[model samples]
Target chain A: EDQVTQSPEALRLQEGESSSLNCSYTVSGLRGLFWYRQDPGKGPEFLFTLYSAGEEKEKERLKATLTKKESFLHITAPKPEDSATYLCAVLRISEGGSNYKLTFGKGTLLTVNP
Target chain B: GAGVSQSPSNKVTEKGKDVELRCDPISGHTALYWYRQSLGQGLEFLIYFQGNSAPDKSGLPSDRFSAERTGGSVSTLTIQRTQQEDSAVYLCASTSGPSYNEQFFGPGTRLTVL
Candidate 1:
């Protein structure tokens, strides 16, 4: 079974404060790693995809890096609007074929106070 | 719509009632996915539909939970004899194609079971 775990169930940060959220995973054969941001009462928005170790992607205030066992989402000088839940998912190819299904983590809830 | 959309943004029903949540995927997206988000449970994959093939329903928790995608455009998730455990936000997303693609999300439907 594919499993994903995230750290810091809840995080509180002031405006301009930087922080990082961690996501660790264990899967049979990894196809990809994904990051998503979700606001209250809304669906998750895709942020980035890390295909291999030592890979990183940046979007405005969010940056995601991946290693062999875990991925990190770094927020730089975040604003109040950046406060939301961050989710990580992994793609595991099925035993027989490449079935498209993502195993998701419990997510890290981040609150940025202005 | 430019993004995925779900109907009945909020629903409140009795424990034994049946409810159907609807999802409209992006115009040209070929891959659609369903997920559930509960407090502390994070995001759980419920099902996935690609084209006209058999949906990947491995994530569905029970036989009472079922879903269908018609014409490869819109999808509906049905829950029979709703239970308190079924109370959560049902999220839907669509991607252009392939599991590696970025999936766009919809504003989920919040289901509250009494």
Candidate 2:
């Protein structure tokens, strides 16, 4: 079974503080690693996709890096508006042949206090 | 709508009642997916539909969970005899065609069983 685990179930950061969220995964033939941000009652917003190890992608104050077994989302000098849950997911082939599905982590709840 | 949209953003129901959640994917997109997420858990894949291909129902948790995509456009997820354990946010997403592309997500339907 493909599995994804995120670290530090919750985090509280003062405005301007920087930190990183971790996502570890175990899958058979990784197709992609995805990052999403979800607010209180809204759907998840797509953030980035890292296809290969050593691949990195950045948007505004967030930077995502991936390795063989894990991925990290780095936030720098975040603002209160950046506070939200960060989700990590992986896409891989299912045991059912030619089929694939996304396995997501529980996600890290980020609170950026101004 | 430009992005995926779901109906009945919030639902509160009795444990024995059945519920149907709806999703409208982006026009021209050929892949759609359904997922379930408990309060603090990761997303659990439920089902998937792609263009002209057999729908993948491997992630469905039980026989009570079923989904259908009518005419290759909108999709519906039905959960019968709901249990308290079934309370969660049901999310829907879609991609253009391949499984590797970024999947756009809907706001999700928050289901609460009383």
Candidate 3:
């Protein structure tokens, strides 16, 4: 069974504080790993897609790194506007080598206080 | 360009009633997906549609849940005999081609079953 787990269910960080969120996964075959940001009352926004280990992608203050077993979303000097639930998801390759379903973690809620 | 869009930002219905939620994927996008997010739970994959292929309904929780994509553009998710447990945010997303691409999401429809 493919599973995704995210740690630090909730984090409170002061403005300009840097922190990292973790997303661990166990899958038969990993096709891709995705990160998203979701605000209250809204759907998730696309962040990054990591296809292989040792891969990294960045946007503004957000950086995402991937490994064979896990992924990390690092926030650098986050601002109040950066507070949101960070979600991690994985696409697993099925026996037929074709699958579109994404298994997601519970997500990490970050509260950046101004 | 307009991203994926869902109708009826909010829906409130009584138990035993039926409801339909709609999704319009980004123009030219051939793949569409639906997911559910319950309180304190991770996003759950509900369905996937790619081009003219049969949808992947394995993620649907029950037979009461059904979805269809018309013209490979607009999709609708229908839930029959709504239950209190069915209350959650139904999110819609789309991708250009395959699962390896980043999915663009809509604002989601907040479904409340009374």
Candidate 4:
């Protein structure tokens, strides 16, 4: 069974603090790994897509890195406005073919206190 | 340009009732997806439609959940005989194409079943 597990279900940090969120997966064949930020009462917003091992993507204060079995989202100097649930998902190839459906993790709820 | 959009930001209905949620993807996006997010749970894929091809409904939890993409644009997800367990946020997303593309999501519709 394909599973995506995100660690640290909830994290509270002071403004300007940096931390990393982990998303480990066990899948048949990984096609891509995705990161998203979701605010309360809103749908998730796309962040980055890592297609292969050693790939890293960045925007603003967020950086995402991927490996063979897991992915990490590193936040640098996060602010209060950056507080949101960080989600990780994976697309894997199944017996039928490359499945476009995403298997998501139980996102990490990050709270940045000012 | 506008991103994906969903109607009835919130819906409250009694158990055994039926409800329909709607989604309008971005212009020119050929792939549309529907997912459900339960409280404290990961997002679960429900269905996918790409171009004029038949929708992939493998992830749908039960027969009561059905979705349709009309004219390769607007999509609707219908839940029949809703139950208490059916209460969740129904999210819609879209991509230009299927392969490893970042999916843009809409502000989800919060469904409450009493």
Candidate 1 true-interface contact recovery = 0.88
Per-residue error (Å), model 4, residue B105: 0.3
Task: Report the Cα lDDT for residue B88, model 3.
Answer: 97
Candidate models: Cα lDDT each? 0.92, 0.93, 0.93, 0.93
* A31-61 per-residue lDDT for model 3 (tens digits): 8999999999888998999999999999999
Model 1 segments more than 4 A misplaced: none
Distance (Å) between predicted and true CA of A14, model 4?
0.9
| Candidate 1 TM-score restricted to chain A | 0.97
CA deviation > 4 Å runs, candidate 2: none
Residue B7 local lDDT, model 2: 93
What is the two-chain DockQ of model 3? 0.82
Q: DockQ for each of the predicted structures, in order?
A: 0.82, 0.83, 0.82, 0.82
Q: Give residue A14's error in model 3 in angstroms.
A: 0.6
Candidate 4 residue A21 C-alpha distance from true site, Å: 0.6
- Interface RMSD of candidate 2, in Å, is 0.9
TM-score per candidate for chain A alone = 0.97, 0.97, 0.96, 0.96
TM-score of each: 0.96, 0.96, 0.97, 0.97
Which regions of candidate 3 deviate over 4 angstroms?
Answer: none
For each candidate in turn, give its C-alpha RMSD to the true structure in angstroms. 1.2, 1.1, 1.0, 1.0
Candidate 3's displacement at residue A3, Å, is 1.0
Candidate 1 per-residue lDDT, tens place, A1-104, comes to 78899998899999999999999999877889999998888888889999999999999999999999999999999999999999999987776584866889
